[model samples]
Target chain A: MALTDRCDIFGSVHEKGINRIVRHLMRQRPSLFNYGTAFFLRNPNLLCERIQAAPEVLQAHDPLLSVQDPVPILGAAIPLGLNWCLQFTDLQIDFHPGNVFHLPNELGNLPAQRLALRMRGCFGLDCPSEEFIREILPQVEAEEVAQRGKEVFGTKERQPAAPEREPIVLPTRKLQCLCVELFAVLHFEWGTIPGNPQQWLKLRLDGLEIVDLGPAPLEEMAECYIRAVLKLGILPRLSVPIEAMVLNITELMRKQGLAIGETITLQPTPVPAGVPNNPAVEDDRLKAFINLVVEV
Target chain B: MAHFTLAVSEGTFRRSFDLLKRNLRFSKSDQASFGIFVAGYDVRAHLEGGTLDLRADNTISVRELDIRWDRLRFTLGINIPEICVGGGCINMPWPIPDICLPRVCVFSGNPDISISPDLAAFVAQEVSFTGRVVARYFDASVPPPLPDLCAPIRIEPLPDHNQWHIHIDPQTIDVDLFDFPDIVGNLIENTLSNAVRAIIPGGFVRDIILAIIGGIADFIRFLLDIPDEIDEWLSDLFNVSFGLLDFIGTLVLDFFSTCNPIYRIDDPFELLPASNGLIPVRIPLRNLSVRVNDAEMVAEVDIGG
Candidate 1:
């Protein structure tokens, strides 16, 4: 092993003895030994040496040699000369035992469920308490704005002093037929009849009475009920006929000269009864979770 | 004085942080009642290159943040039988290349790092990051520029351990794309207004007026193209930034919140030797201050609390 280590075959593997034997074999039997001599002359060890010399080719095969993936190699080779902020003498932070609030061991295994739901074009408002104002109203407003944009480009109220008396209007045709579904889930913790928990909820859209799913029964023990249905009078029908109907309505009001680019609002409102004037959301025992969704 | 402080090198942090990679995929199928049907959606993002650096003044810098998306693919079906609009589903897939946000630097600028001792944790100072974020939709040649992001991280220490557990509160990363409407409108007006007028061939005053109004409609439609699913996806994707800010911000908090034991000193409760042959002592740590250098930080504290 020591002799093998000392005898270094640096670049070309064609040693003196090996080269002499290969030449003698080729000369003795020209046709038969020519291929064998050539194979021996083009040694695999020499090929390896050549590959080691050409780093780009080697890197193409082995990502460890490539610059794009140098983390594995550089991480081991280079030290991370991190200059810390604190000195060796003053690195300690005061550990105040009183700072930590230890929870009871019984509560450690409390079942906490986690759910991730991805909803599209649905506005959800969640608050620690009911006192937190309608936080999801802004989302509703944004939805309203998006619906309004679909109707027209925008109203351009030209100045009175300008040559044109009327504003520049860009009118758009609504989708031929469409139906929207409004869904809501209510979780009532209390304030309802225990045997038969029933409640009335009303929903309105675009100044049109959508639906009032009269009275729905709730489950027991923090009862949760899901109530979903088509909007009230505007059933799933041909939107072309609906458009013509709207046009007839517009014709009746034509004397007023229904201006172009006028916005048609689609506002959604939910009213759930059986709660105090202002439900105290902070009271965990008397809490309710209401989630509203509008699918168009 | 009972004190202990530990110093973790940048290499040590990198070695410890080598296990944060996973495949993320999402698919959703929605058939809306409003003449819109999406058969299926496949969104994939593969995180490739990642490197971390612990900077001075409690800052963590990531040099390479590359995310390669397989494709933003979906099949859209619009069902409106009336007005010659029949119901049919077409495969609409987006071919988006990789997005690399290089050298994303995040640091705590605010000096007020609030500590909730009751929770055994500290709310990291409002962490801010500098990185160029872009959100491009299918068929959109140019993506929208994202605003800078800033947020806070809650960092807590683990008992009997030298490391601190860092949690990213996603609610804190605030990036608003409310100006998208304004941007789209401006783009349409600038690029289309003159072109529309040129094509209309109207020299008369009345004709010119008609041309202007007609052109605005075309511009609005082009601007509001792909409003439903693709627009929402781009907006949501950009809004989250692949949780890069959250991940890197947590690293910064972890580095800053680490209570390493550099030196451990015993604390004697009393001034004299105790009856059990133990000295009663206390280490008074006082006058704590931290100063930042270009690439280094120097902290000084007295032996008195």
Candidate 2:
């Protein structure tokens, strides 16, 4: 048989085992996936006027801003703010049935594998509100008019007084069952961590697809954001340090007082094809093959 | 299929076996006094030149592993019979005074001649056996029992923890009897003769003493109670009388099975080292088993969660 058909050392972990590991990562390292960003409105007049005519703009809705406070915009003089944050809690990962993680058949195509990850969690998002923008429109308009007056007449002018507006505090709207299905081709890299020569195995995001994100524009934006986070933030931390896997049999023997010169070096080898229950193609397990080299 | 599997080719296994053999050392001394003669030996031997064959039947055949004796000092002590003459008085010529002779002795008393000939590099034996590879689990939690002083071979127990010990369990051992060369018998005889000659007078007196004791070789042989072939006799003396054969066989068995394990793997085998305050990842090994084939030896194990 070919070397690719057999291995000196073989090891595999079941899908259940992978799920357990995922759960552990989620519990111990939650900061990897939970993040937020804010957007400040440059002009609040446009949105403020629209909210004032329609009070229902402040109500909770999907794919749109959800207002925490539904109070009417008494005066359009308050400055408006828009910010969004996503916090995921109780996150769980599932490798959908019949869709297993597996290595490509060709060795040249190695380091790349196909996998699908379906993540479900309690997702919370702090979205932009129309009422807050409407409340701050009058102040923004007065400031703009004064700026124009200064440019044309070159004189200081007093603006009309307006009622003070309370600062809008948008509450995070939480969804109990927010599901994200990711179909991606993952590539693996084996190298030492920078500044530390310990061997590590890391998986990189090569290609990604968001199965459903409503429309084309939304899907594209979601895919770009998720891909960036996975590539730059989460994937790098998913390394498995394998320095300990290279067992020094000679050293162990010497420690036991057996004087021997031969050393057993185990290095990761390509997972052989056509093996029964191949870890890569088999959805049930994740497996690895190692080549053993005895050095004198 | 097991969670983990490891296959070691025959060539690799031989390398490991050679290392183990090189590190193994056996040194022991014993003595026994049996009425007329006393015999003892202080020996040190090492294993070398073994043919290790992995068989298709899942057994290992070890043949001709020479037990090379580095030091083989055989000590013998024998009490020689005393020789005295000329002590009685003789009457002659009717009433003329009797003539009396003073006693002459070959030795002051019955001497016990002890001889330790240079028996250093000639004694050797071959040990052969067929065995199956077996694994034993050592549990560190339980306290070990007290040592058995009366056991055939006593091994000092070392503290072991949760480890899988792989041993070659011999089914039967066939150890060749120690074979001494003809020169060894001559060496012993010459030493004994020299020791006796050193204690006795030379010239006519020595001749007279020789005549009285019959041939010196005969006398020594009679004292040792051995047949004509001294080398065969000496071989028997070591192999049977002194129980060296049984001792060697038992020693080999105990050495491989109890004193040392061919291979050992610690339970909860550490796969990663602890760094940055994180605990090392260790996977517990379970149901470990080993088997031998014509091409290789294989070990299969499961990982405990």
Candidate 3:
């Protein structure tokens, strides 16, 4: 029951070949793997201080949670300082019989094929102290209060507010290094993407496992975050458009002045294990089967 | 081991061969003179019906491939010897002197009679060959040399590619001589006899002249210098005198080698298409080789950076 037994054509890319592609893509397109947010700090010390020092900690009004707001939180204009950043580099990939990262028992037991990825980077978050928040909040509230009064009274004349405070410089620690390793099982499905009529051989992330996260709860959270990133941000890039794989014999014949009105398409065929050259994740090779179909 | 390898099953190879066969065509016209008698042929033939075998020894064996004649016209030129009658000097008395009678000649001189008859439907040829599939890399950057215009026959041009050309390198080729039916001999004899008879007198005179000629068929066979079996003679006329066999062999060789390739693969194989203004991803191919097993023809290639 090997993959070749059920398929008319079979192909495989070895681990070395895969690694070569990964290296080229990672170097040329670094932005694909790196992400960061200014508010979400990677440094736990600063993040804790910002949360504890806030004045309205218990009754804080989150713009995101407001249902009846005039402007949506995403579209609303908000002024924020850039204080945190995360960047991943030195990304590496490996096919199963895992080498770079170990697969957990749950992931290892899965019947699906899998691959592991290891990446290392650094991130940092900066949060203002209690004194700085107290000083900044009142000035911001006073300016807002004056702006509201003018709008309520229907005044056309300009109104002068209190003098602006000088910019304050806060001391912060350097970014801390972080290493992440993840294992994901692979799944193959045939479907079409929205807005595109052509079919595609899609490679989907069946499952995700974050390796060595130290604690169970933290590992669970990290797994969820990484899964979302991989599923939404990365897997789509790997989906192969079936139209690209078609042999296009009709067009070639037309070029040669042959009027055979038949087209040959290279379609992926199902493969079962134990077949010679079976399409599977084994011996560090990702193999698949393809067959040619003629359409008139 | 290469980064990528593709194996085409024998069934698939046969499909490609069939396509090539469908498009294959060969037509030639040539004339040659053997002493006083001249022979010529205009032939148009095509390939059909062959058993394609992929051998484990890494060669392809094509057996009994029929070369079907679409149009085959054989032309023969025979120079009739002088035929004369009633020519002699009448003996006269010495004093009266000799008086001579004029010679009555059937023809003014040696006349060359030409006969062009279509023998295509009656004749056929079979060819067998064994060859290995060889892969040749074509570099598109370099221009190909100009063709030899002065040559008797010009070979078809090949693509100066960025392509992997798969050609059949023939090791051995066997082409059968053109086989003619027994009726072909009679057909030619009758045509020549009628042509000769047309110029002679009719009725009693014609019969006497034909009898003197000693059977028009025998007369023609003697003039053409042919054996008793007209079919065998005709076969030799076309095969050896006309050099049709040699022409066919060379044509077959050129057809399989340079004129057409069994398969072609682009050198820089495109794996992904350009999208959203991004350049297409292409991998360079190198060291492409082909081998045939009992079940399939395997082509192996290495990926270049």
Question: Highest TM-score: which candidate?
Answer: 3
Cα lDDT tens digits for candidate 2, B171-250:
54556555332224334555655665888858887666655444554455344433323433443334322245644675
Better of 1 and 3 by DockQ: 3
Worst 10 residues of 2 chain A by lDDT: A48-57
Top-DockQ candidate index:
2
Residue B34 C-alpha lDDT in model 3: 78
Show model 3 residue runs off by greater than 4 Å: A1-8, A28-101, A104-106, A109-179, A189-206, A212-218, A225-256, A260-278, A290-296, B15-46, B69-127, B135-168, B174-287
Candidate 1 regions off by >4 Å?
A: A1-296, B1-9, B22-33, B36-40, B80-305
Q: Residue B239: error of model 3 in Å?
A: 24
- Interface RMSD, all models, one decimal each? 35.5, 10.6, 10.9
Candidate 2 deviant stretches above 4 angstroms: A1-184, A187-204, A210-219, A229-248, A261-296, B19-46, B72-120, B135-169, B177-288, B303-305
lDDT of 1 by residue, B1-305 (tens): 11111123344335333422232232333433333322434444444345655444244444333333344444444443323233344444567544433443233222112221221011111122222111111112333234312112212222231211222222112222222332344455545656656776666764666567557754664465344224324433454333454545545543333322222222211223323322222223333333322232223333322
lDDT of 2 by residue, A215-260 (tens): 8899789888988999998998787777656777667767887656
RMSD of each: 46.3, 18.7, 17.8
- Write the candidate numbers in order of decreasing TM-score: 3, 2, 1
What is the lDDT of every predicted structure here?
0.28, 0.55, 0.59
Question: Can you list the residue pairs that collide in candidate 3?
Answer: A1-A273, A1-A275, A2-A274, A2-A275, A3-A278
